[model samples]
Target: MKRKILLSALLLPAVMAFGQQYGGMWIPTELNEKEMKSLGMKISAKDIFNPDKASIKDAVVQFDGGCTAEVISPKGLLLTNHHCGYDNIQSHSTVENDLLTNGFWAKDMNGELPNPGVTVDFITDIKEVTAQILPGTENLTGAELTKKINENIEAYKKAQKTESYQTISVRSMYYGNKFYAYVIETFKDIRLVGAPPSAIGKYGSDTDNWVWPRHTGDFSMFRIYADKNNKPSEYSKDNIPYTPKHFLPISIKDKKEDDFTFVFGFPGRTTEYLPAIAVEKIMTETDPAMIAVRDVALKTLDEKMRVDPATKIKYASKYARVANYWKKWIGEVEGLKKSNAVEKKKQYEQTLISKNPAIKPTIDGLNQKYNEQAPYNLHKAYYSEVVRNSETLTLAGIYSNYIKAYEEGKMDAKNNEALKARLTEVYKDYDAELDAKVTAKILALYANKTPAQFLPKDFGMLKDANKNLGTIENMSKMSVITGRGNLNGIKTSDLNKLFENPKALVANLKKDPLVEMYGSFKSSYFETTDAKVTALQTDIDALQKKFMAQQMETDKDRKFFPDANSTLRVTYGQVKGSEPRDAVSYGYQTHLAGVMEKYVPGDYEFDVPKKLISLYNSKDYGVYKDKTGDVPVNFTATNHTTGGNSGSPALDAYGNLIGLNFDRQWEGTMSDINYDPKLCRNIMVDTKYILFVIDKYADSKWLLNEMKIVK
Candidate 1:
């Protein structure tokens, strides 16, 4: 079936059987049913992701990206994004482990280790019973409101108990305006399945992070495990794999222009309902400013890390985090500029108001609040967001003062003991070598480059002190390293000794440089993070309540989808390509062979393992193909996706996930606002490539047997 014909047919019914073509799956509310069917979807919205499908709950998986996954097989098989599982991969790798360098393999079932602190959930039910819940919520307290909502849910659950779907849950939407219940069967035996080497997985790393013409294979694998009863269970060697009710079928057919598709999994957030003015600020100011802050921080960290290897390791996690947000904010800004998302939103709002009289005032009121609130948030962000992070060294000074005071008999028992305990807990996770490196990296840049304007007036700074602390110098000169170790190594009795002498403590404070800086830095830090946070919290909580209220207002005539709330939700779009940012639309065609051409061996990030590099250099292109070519190293598809979609499945028509959507091109990063097929191309690694690595490199044939693989 050709994609164009399929698209035309699918769109035909939506436009009143006329000649106009309905766009891609842009309007989730108005899905092109006929077109979707042409592409091989046999299920309705109710059927495909129905709350009734016992498997929908069972199939769901929660990813670190705030994404979701589903169980595909009975033998503990889980599926999620390469980026979603990136942390786990990085964590399991150290100097000796080097899993990121060579990749990881259990070889046999016995070798697999369970991941700690990760869990997968299945939503049992979601429904709307607006008739039963909304009338009396106006006068209730927050807790009272929650209680009423829960009470309504309990009644529904009790009424529905005599059914086959016995495992049930109730949800209240739109604050208290609506209610629903669900019956679910959750499985707990999920485990790590497979992942490619970073050479293939995070190929371009930060360089190609938000860029298109990408060659990254961002995907990972996990499996669901269950007890013999096929019910959810904690990890145990004897647990069996779960059997999914209707797993997505696979297809080799590619999605071309205008293909009908849907994205499934929880989308972390979307403020699409915001006013035009709010959208304008995000496009013009907020994102760019935030990106600038991140850029400054990243550059500062990178410079120090590059000069000193010791500092590099300490700032590794911090660098990754700043880079991640920097990439996202940059991508979003560029995408919005190219797609004119703000302009389109303005036009959309105008049209809505022009056509509907009542909705206009409703929108007007909303826009007023939106405009008033946007800039306030951004101004607050600078001081508050960076306060804790930027002042850590200063806080350390405060701790030093307390310690020295106790040892010299200048501090009381309670204050002396408290300081030691706090410092003791913190250093347990602290890496001294890394800490020094990170600290130096931050201090050097601020000292050498930044204008004094960035800091508050009293920031007498480390540069002014010249590594010399009057009294603080003497205490730090009395080094605290001898007592370094996690909780188990520190003795409570030894902590008592520091408090016995208070004069030495008072003298130590005068020598600690960090403490000298803090005497000035403390008031401002409190002014921003603590005081401002308290102020912001009041407003944010009020907004949450109003957000709840807004949901209630829309419930009468609309099925209100919650505001993500960073909760799980499954969105469905198709494997497609778009022309969101420019004249030439995007296309779906990338091959594994192109990875070699894009490769730059020994180029830091391009430093691939000997094996995968050899495979590419040796023309081990495998059998990947496209209509006009062999395969592209990377291709862009017009699938709806966002940050949390990091580890989402790019399934084919038969529903078998053919690729994993990890990112969008830099030009289309603003896809969360308005999707433009040309620029908003989704980044995915071919399933075939994932398979090739597993079969040729990892040699894990047991996993291959579990899936219905086709050549």
Candidate 2:
């Protein structure tokens, strides 16, 4: 029988059974080939993972959006999540030149705009540093063990130093029972290459974020220019193409059930090892709370943005950003409860505890800690938003701490140096204009809410936004919002100019009693959060140890791996199809016709420009057709995925990339809660759709000529 759509095998407390299935930093060399093959993988893990074999390295890129990406060219080229690059493309759109609303094309290679903050990560090499670092250690106590391990690592670093990359990350997998050192190559020379119009790119938008039977060409392109030697270097016209060892071959055919496939990328995090009770709390209380808050925020933003054509364009990116993940969270939460993930985990924990009383009390202790911390989370989210709008006292507090430490000469040399470097580096990404707009938007949101629901309670400081904002009692009515208003529908740049009296940053930071209240709140918040986190760490670390202990006993049937601890992790699942929440079954099937179905003629979400609609109307569907059928634009695979899996490379049996995994069909949005092979399928745009858009629609042959396409 196929795995039921069960995120958790059974319900149980997480502190007991939930932390077991978490596989940490699994080396590509270590994926269970035999098991993977049984799950329908045609290629061996070694085939896809071996950097020396075929072009796997060139096929892998760390998708900053969430998943991983790879260089498919010797020239600066990148392939990643369509959703990941969506907002980046939208950011370049504006009133007269709205790329997002009308969609964007460089018209030529030179027209490609340099994206400011986007960065692509390249994995240079990964090594098992166990023997080199943990030569003789075997389960030592917490502090002493950490000290000894660090000392060992420090000596190893000093003795065997070779600098090919800037940050060498050591990830503990199998619950800190094993370790892998990944040396990453980072490049900031990435630029937006091409993207389909929103009609094709974001087709479904809010109506289809995490749902299935999905048809969205969610893909984007970026070019990366390396130094003359093709090594990592700063952006320079003097730089040359980064000739990569491999690039994925474009296929116009769809995948089949049990068809051999693989994916390579940096998956963010997962909690496959959480105990049942903890899962329950999240599914029932925590997820519900987050959903409730996010819904209000998204609805408010959506309603307010539709006020005018200009306002809609101004807030387009903002609305998408808020709604995209808000629906995802809601779906996951709803899916979790429906799939009975929490309950399954609970039962699993009970079974473990019944069999092993030695670990029961400790597990129970962990459960107690999770319960105590859960309630404060809602307040934390609400207040966290408040804190971001206020002059960022968290960073300021840290700075103050650093100053105090420096004055006392008590700061460690390494930490002091790191702090200074980080502070300086942060300013490069800081935009005062964006900040003012975001600050105003959030403050205005709080300012407009009912007094009882007010978060910071204005204290008569915030000029009432109720009078300041454009008032329309019905936001969803859409047509009533006539676009004209004072500060209500004003542009951010215009608002900054209007509020140019003494600058809002310094004004809010130095605003008399408010500043003092903020300082006091910041101090209290820091102290409280620090103490709680510190106390929580003790148990959390203990939980980690317990997780590691179980993982060490994997004796072959299944190697117990620890869940992700905000550290690194590697989860392995074959490319397979699924059926989800609704009776919808996602297949390796998608048609270009669906793209036009997502078009709504001029609605912001459904806007279709005449030139593009002309092409579609001309029945000029390009080479996006599949071998099995014609007009295949998007497809689904039985690949297990989640939030962190975005931008992951879905590959064929030859270890070649097939598609970029982005989201799962809505039915399987609950895939994280329970990976249902029947209903939980990961969705991706066919690689051919990408090529067609680039070569035909966008007409950027320079970028297309770089890729390796196999007909």
The candidate scoring highest on lDDT is 2
Residue-level lDDT of model 1, residues 328-391, one tens digit each, is 7777887777767777767865765555545565556556655555545554454433333332
lDDT of 1: 0.55
By TM-score, how accurate is candidate 1?
Answer: 0.73
Candidate 1 Cα errors over 4 Å, as ranges: 1-43, 51-58, 87-96, 129-133, 139-185, 253-258, 305-317, 355-364, 367-375, 388-562, 566-587, 617-634
lDDT of each: 0.55, 0.57
Cα TM-score per model: 0.73, 0.74
